[model samples]
Target: MFIGGLGRSGTTLLERLLGEVPGVAPLGEVVHLWERGVIGKEPCGCGEPFTTCPFWRRVGIRAFGGWSTGLADRILTLRRRVDRTRHIPALAARRCRVGLSGYTRAYSRVYEAAAQVAGGRVVVDSSKHASLAFCLRTSPVVDMSVVHVVRDPRAVAYSWRKQITRPEDGTPMTRWPSAWTAVHWLVQNLAFELLARRGGTVIRVRYEDLLADPPAVMQALLTRLGLGGVAVTFLRQGVAELSVAHTCAGNPMRFAAGPLDLSRDDNWCDRQPRLHRWLVTALTWPLMLQYGYRPRDRRTPEGAVAPWLTAGVAAQECR
Candidate 1:
């Protein structure tokens, strides 16, 4: 499973939850493994530095005959050429299969290795980048399913404005202005919707709904993913017992484990500034309403999205 969405929309939490499933292994964010995991040697979710984690050590040997500066740099270069948002148009049209193949081979090796190391549990990658998701769609080696997570745009904007820390390297998390995050939120979610329309096992999951009923949402998710018989041992009545994961690069929350409260946090409703909230609603109202989010004001500007496109995403969500 490839869980894709904007960064702060609970993708990490979702992965950790899914990892507790009997036949699942959550990989934090393989998209950043070259830089954050291999080159920089950040802490893996297991509390070992990536280079020392036995799982990752085995993954390196299995995936690329051992991770090296040359391998990391080569894959990073391939990523630059093939995985940017600007390349999405060509990727979606299947016009860049040749360009994507090399990257896809290297990328699939990571998942393939992790699955073998985890005793063949289904691997879950919470990369959360639509462009990377598009690239993976063409992989001959991966049978990928996507859970496109969406949170309220206002809440997501608030998250981007905060000052958080990256625990592994003691660096501050990146911050963005509400307007920039709003636009990013718009584009990122749109890209996933485009992925849905293009076809695959794509499911839309609202952050709010997941919080409301953890076990039900999780079980339904597995069923949708065609793993319905897997025992739902992780989530229990809005609480969970999280196990250590080996996710690569993601929010610092990746390190957290044990009992977790799946609570509904509406801090943004009271704390986000009024103007920024309005700005996000204005920019994302069309897609917002499609996902059952009601903007403060429901007047969508003319031509914000083609009518057919709107209908297309909604139809795709049901599939």
Candidate 2:
């Protein structure tokens, strides 16, 4: 399964919760693994360098006959060539398949290898990039389902301005200004909506709903995916039981394990700059309302119905 959303939109949190599900294997962000995990030798979720981690080592061997600086470099170059947000338009045309063959094959190999390494558990890739999602759509070998997670634009914009540190490397995580985030947020979400209109199973979920009632959200997802037998015992009483897995690059929270407090992080309401919030809402008003986010009600009242297409969500979970 692929989790699609903008950065800092709770994709990591959803993936971590899904990791605890039986018959599921979480691969943090394979879209970044070629560079961050393989070339840069960043820490995996297990807290070991990807080159030294047994899980990734096996994946490399299975995927490409073993890891080497040369192979990593080659794939990284291919990734940049074919996988990019701007390339989504061409990829959607589906006529670029011939040119994208190399990366498509490489990507399929990574998931295949991961599935093999994880004893055939379903691989959950929380890459959270609309461009990457479209790239994967071109691959015949990858059977992907999308969990399109949406959050309030104001909250998402506020998140982009905060300083965060990467747990994988000692470097700081990427941060974007509110305007930049607003534009990308609109584009990314629209891309996913376009993707659903084209093909494949795409289930939409509000990030607020997921944070508020993880058990219900996760159970609804599993049941929709026909994995109704899997128990979501890991989430209960507003806490999530996280386990170490070989996730690649993601939010620093990916490094966290054991019991984690699943409180709603709504720091944006009061802390965000009024100018930034207004700009974000103005830039994204039309689609924002389509997603059920109120333009005036920037402050999502505590315990109120999550601002989203709840009926659309219910239809998806049932289907």
Candidate 3:
């Protein structure tokens, strides 16, 4: 049961919790062939390095032609050579689709090989990308179960702004103006919404509820995936330490490494900049309303029907 979604949408938390479960192998973001030069890295908190890691090593054994580690590095170089200065959406789409095809081929080969190595029925990959999700679903080798994880739009924009501003001299992305950011939030969410509805076992998970009560949320997910009851013991242990990788080489992000941490809910209220809160709300307002988020603008918040409150959340009271 692969847990897929947008970045920073609690995939790591889910991976960690599920990793603790017996009989389930959790390799967070093993996007091995997507970009290259990843294997020689240090142990990701999951207790293994890319090169020496049993997971990838086994995956390497079965991959048809034994693709080199340098494959990802080469792809990165080619991507950098592309010119995308004007930010034209049509051009961007055309260029991205062209490049995406190669990556998809490599990804499919690597995962198919890795699946053989793991010897487990399911491999959880939290490398969330709508395009990749689309490709994987269509691939003959993959029988993917996509988990469309979502959070408030304001929260997403807030986090994006934080990461974009951090110390990165190379490949820095321009910050989206609030309106543009909202538009992006809607677009990405809409993509997932459409995919989920077209559905064959697509699950939508909310970051808020997942953080608020992980064990219960996880149990429901495992049941839905038909993962049996083996995950229960892992849930009782609280959290597990796991390794993770980013889309770029040498740019790994750990689960507990930074400010917009997922170990808790309401991270937005705590870590978000004052300005981002408004932008987040504006962009994600419709979604927030749709997903049962209480609308602050209304006298009676959205979804506030009497007896609507579950006993567990009743003490918190309605907004």
Candidate 4:
């Protein structure tokens, strides 16, 4: 029961929701174990420092073989040397095969480790990345059910702009580059598109709809996973409490909840300028509209805001 989507695409929110259901263990971003050895003192949103967390300690013992505590300590120590900025492209280029073999091995390690300790056939991983998803679909170790979460691009960019701003940097945040955001969203969602075409269990979830009506959304999600009738316990925590902002690299699963903040839906209108609006629309209009976003021209005057991409794309730009 792995749950994933783009960074900042509500992966954390979804994991916590699913975790509340009995029999489901939603581990935020156990991605550390597979990240080719980069870690941080950043505590997991699971409410434990990674190395000291009971959950990860068990995972370490079962997956790597040895004292869980010792393995966790080693991971934290090795993690210190990691250069966050370059790890992804470097590892994806160097270790990930265009084929499925390498991916299966990597995913197997993580899944087996989780299952061994958690004692569940399904695992929830909110570390959304399309490339990784594609690799897992073809891997022998995992039978993945992908939920590609979509959100409005404007809201996503707005959220990202806020998140990236730093008091020390003293630089105002700007809209994410449209071309970059557009291509990234396209490729990642397209990964799911291709996978669905290949004939497998894949679901597309809209974040807007999920938040708007959680019970229905969650029920449908569990049914798809063949785990039905689970109690839906939605946590109401603040955003920072849930944020993995201080965690290793960054895990979207670390978000705090609050009263329904639908303001996030159209936040880009307030954040992006006229030019960025034009650029984002021109580059992403076709894809954006495909997943429930309406162009400004089609919207009512009151809704005459800029066009938005799907929630998935929107969240990426923001994150």
Q: Sorted on TM-score, highest at the top, how do the candidates line up?
A: 2, 1, 4, 3
Off by over 4 Å in 3: 30-33, 36-49, 73-105, 163-181, 237-267, 270-275, 297-319
lDDT of 2 at 4: 91
Query: Per-residue CA lDDT of candidate 1, range 149-201, in tens?
Result: 88888888899999998888788999999989888888998898888789866
User: lDDT at 62 for candidate 3?
Assistant: 73
TM-scores for all predictions: 0.92, 0.94, 0.69, 0.70
lDDT tens readout by residue for model 2, 172-201? 878898999999999998999888877757
lDDT of candidates 1 onward, in order: 0.82, 0.83, 0.53, 0.53
True-vs-predicted CA distance for residue 192, candidate 2, Å: 0.4
Candidate ranking (lDDT, best to worst)? 2, 1, 4, 3
Off by over 4 Å in 1: 297-316
What TM-score does candidate 4 get on C-alpha atoms?
0.70
Model 2 deviation from native, Cα RMSD in Å: 2.2
lDDT assessment of candidate 1: 0.82
> Cα lDDT of model 4 overall?
0.53
Q: For residues 197-230, what per-residue lDDT tens digits would candidate 3 score against the true structure?
A: 5553567777766665566666666666667465
- Clashes, model 1: 1
Candidate 3 local accuracy as lDDT? Answer: 0.53
- The candidate 1 region of ten consecutive residues with least summed lDDT is 300-309
